[model samples]
Target chain A: MTPLDFVVSLALISVAAGVLGSLVGLGGGVVIVPVLTIFYGVNIRLAIGASIVSVIATSSGAAAAYVRERMTNLRAGMFLEVATTTGALSGAYLATLLPERFLFAFFGVVLAYSSVITYRKRHEDQLLAVSNDRIANYFNLHGSYYDEAEGREITYKVSGTKLGLVLMYIAGLVSALLGIGSGALKVPAMDGAMHLPMKVSTATSNFMIGVTAAASAGVYFIRGQIDPIIAAPVAAGVLLGATFGARVLGRITSRTIRLLFVGVLVVISLEMLQKGLFP
Target chain B: MMTRQSPGPDPQKNVTPEGDLQVSGRHRNLSPAQVAAMEEKIRKIEFAISLVLRVGVILSVSVIAIGLGVMFYHHGDYTSITGHASYKTLTSRSTPFPHSLGQLRRSLVHGDGRGIVVLGVFLLILTPILRVAVGVVSFFYEKDVPMALVTLFVLVVLIASFFLAGL
Candidate 1:
């Protein structure tokens, strides 16, 4: 294909990825990487570099709307960012020390388990009446949002602050090592452990992924892995798509979001398992 | 923080048919006017954050689009360009690109497409960090000292990651 053709096709595909990523609270790297490498015959390193750019684009683009709508838990996101950023820094160091296959397999199993749990909880109501967790109370992690689908305001208390932080750290580590956003983990942590509403969890995860990806982006840039020609179209396309996706998210029911997320998780988990078991 | 009861029925039910807006947080105990004022302040902070993100994305995408146009203009008839061995080398992992601020500046001076695109990406990367900085300011403005400190710590860790990665 011609360079123009290549760029156009990649951008189109990236737009789709961004839509799904934003809706499901993923970074879209899962889609970006495989397509770039398998279909475009791009180098793995360059594909990963492009994925990093796409993740940030998705995060910032969708977050602009999510934050404005008050769907995102800003305090929770910022507080957990401490763990994620520090974990990313450590993950960069651990990259050379640990076995890649083992890490992938471990995380894969974890994702598979979480996906099942998420599927089982798909019908459960998200808002809890009250929470007695002192750490959560002190941090004031509780939040409320106007549910467009339900046509009412939803208030919920947060719990398991410590578990949520630990999970975020792992999510960050996975993101840095795998060159993915790891929003899969972030959503589950917030939704399940932290007792946040599903939409809030997704929005908060979307809000935080950009910063997590930014932590490692500089390194990728300096290493000459980030090709501008490849990344430019991807970034622009994803940003546009994410903006549209953010608009749709508020209108949809939480059940649909969880189901979609579970589907993505299952696919990603299987992919990780394949890589680990085969490699 | 006192939890003030709403004048009407309980608001914590899973389904509130009345659609009464109940905000639960530090402001849950405040009077209706106080709650409205606090919500307004929070909305302003969120608006500021969103504005930063929106502006940053638009600016970066515009630069990237311009750079793409320049590239297409420079290398007319992209089919021929793709057929050449140079294209393969250019797309390869070993392709030489600007990897530092100084190199990026020099390339931009020469009107290089790649440099311009990378600059856009750099701006894209900076947007989230800028948002975090804005978060600290917003939290501080709200007189939420602990939250502000937490956000500052996150900012420090993000900056520290850059140095750690450099090492």
Candidate 2:
């Protein structure tokens, strides 16, 4: 294909990924990197750089709506950001040192792990007979939000503060290393480990991903991974697709589409793993 | 959905009347005016963030799209991609295209499409940092000193890493 054709195709794929990702509650960055690297023969580093930029774009795009709705817990996001940012620093530093093959393998494994986590829904903790720890109280980790679906204000207390911090550190690390937003890990940490409600966990994770991705995005820029030709289209396409996807998300309830998306992720994961293992 | 009465500590202690007004985790005696002002403050902050994000994305996309158009218009072929814009060629640089701030400025002034694309990506990256900066001010406006400090700390890390990436 011609260069123009190549660029346009990548952009179109990004738009499709963004649409499916937002609909399935996955971010487009994950889908973009593998497509660019495996299909288009773009260098993995350059693909990752573009993916990271797309991640930030989509995060900021979605976050504006969430923040306006008062669904995002600002304190929780900021508090966890400390760990994610620091971890992102270390991860980016390591990215420059790691071998390309190893990076590819790591991405594959992380993708598989993320897919499994995505398949399982987190059940809300029912035991309210719990006590608040001092650190949580001091940091004011607890929050309440008006759930439009339930039509009531739901108040939830946060627990396992220490675990959440440690997990967030890992999430940040993985984010920079792979050049994808680690929302997959962050949401579970907040929802399952910290006992936050699903809506709060999703919103807070969205709020935090931008900051976490930003911490490493700068590093990628200086490292020269961000090819404007690749990054510009990827970012623009994903933002457009994600915005459109979010709008359509509420209207559709297609279980088959969701399952098909997961199947595609699995296939992509295997492709990445094969590339890494062989090359 | 389980709202058990926490007989733990006084909810009053948990609720800082000044800093914790926005959060409804614990009950606090707040006046209607206080709530309205807080809501207004939040609405303003959200509006600011929304504007920053939307403008940044739109501006960047427009510039990059224009750059692509110019690249296609002037070259009229895939020669640049084959010759200089290949993955192998682009990846050889130790820093991103345009190399330095001065170089970027010069190229942008010359209306070089590549430079414009770089600037667009740079703006997209900046959107999050800008939002975080706005967050610090909004947190302070809410009288949430601790959260503001936390946000400030995140901002510091962001900037520090950007410069440190030079090393």
Candidate 3:
């Protein structure tokens, strides 16, 4: 293809990636990796390298709006980073050593498990509270939220701190390995296990995933996994798209966006399974 | 064919807030001694984590820059995968390392479905190892027994899944 043709094709795909990523609260890498690997016939390593750049773009763009709205739990995000960054580095090394088939099959299982989690929690959007351990209160993990529906800023403590960290660690690892942002696991873990509000968790997860991705993305980059020709446009496009998504957050109900998120995950999971077993 | 917003960061405003500046996990108050102790511990940990993050970010950027640099430095002389532009043919006609790297890249970028399928599987196995490390890191830092045990569980599941998949 001509350079112009390549630019146009990439531009079109970039826009689509940004829009979809913003909508689902995901960095575009998951979708990008697949399309590059399968349809475009791009190598997985190059795709991951490009995807990491995109991940930074989407996360940085979205994080700004979330912080402005006071939705992001910055403290929680910072606290969790201690775990994720370390995980990301190790994940990259493992990816380099392991063969490709094993990676795909493993990803397939994760996809299936993620499907079940999404399926089980399809409904119910209430914030439940429980007692926190000494650490939760000691760390000031409690906060108030202005629930638009209830017309009040409800005060609540973050429960299940232990559970949330465990999941965040997993989220970081999967994110590094699969080039996904891991908001799918991070958000739910924060919300259901930790009993943090959905809005708060989503915003926090967005803030955190980049650091996680960066940690591992760095390793991949060093080992020569990323390609700039792809990473540049992809990152730039995703950053723009994520900005738009963050802007649209309150304009529409989160429930609408969430169902769409689940649907996308379902499709991704099925695709992974099919490819893993068949290929 | 689609783009994701790639959710993340921009530096915060210069102005400081009246209360806890960031306000995610700030507790109400503590005695001077308690605060000092917590501050010390948190500080120590934060520096380590920050070092890791900075290294990661720097390394990731450098890699991409190198790739771009290589492409540009060779631009006028660059070859495609096919025809007169064929990088493969040029490499075949050229010397050793570039030829092999090009071949590896060709298999990586444009190989069959089976190649990508294998890559995906590798990503999968690698995740658990990564995840377990994360869990252990957090557990040790936080010293939370429950979280540490749960990390073990995730580790087990990851291992079990890998073996079950016959990998």
Best by lDDT: 1
Cα TM-score per model: 0.90, 0.81, 0.62
* lDDT by residue for model 2 (A83-188), tens: 9999998987786587856766776786677657545642233323233665666666666666665566666677788999999998888788766547767766
lDDT of each: 0.81, 0.68, 0.53
Q: Residue by residue across B97-163, what tens digits does model 3's lDDT show?
A: 2112334456457532222322322232133245345545655554444445544554444454333
Query: For this target, which candidate reaches the highest TM-score against the unseen true structure?
Result: 1
DockQ comparisons of all candidates to the true complex: 0.40, 0.33, 0.06
Candidate 1 lDDT tens digits, A1-279: 677777888899989988888988887787898888888789888988899999999999898767657688877888899899888878877888989888879888999999999999998656666676766655566667789998998777788889999999999998888886379899999999988999889888887899999988877877788898789889998998898898899899999999999999998898788778996
Best of the candidates, DockQ: 1
Clash totals, every prediction: 0, 0, 39
lDDT of 2 by residue, B83-125 (tens): 4344444333443476456777898898877788888877877
For candidate 3, lDDT tens digit of each residue in A123-167? Answer: 655564444355564444445545554455654456677777777
The lDDT-based order of candidates, best leading, equals 1, 2, 3
Model 2, A114: alpha-carbon shift in Å? 6.8
The parts of candidate 2 lying over 4 Å away from their true place are A23-26, A96-131, A146-153, A248-279, B1-29, B78-96
Clashing residue pairs, candidate 1? Answer: none
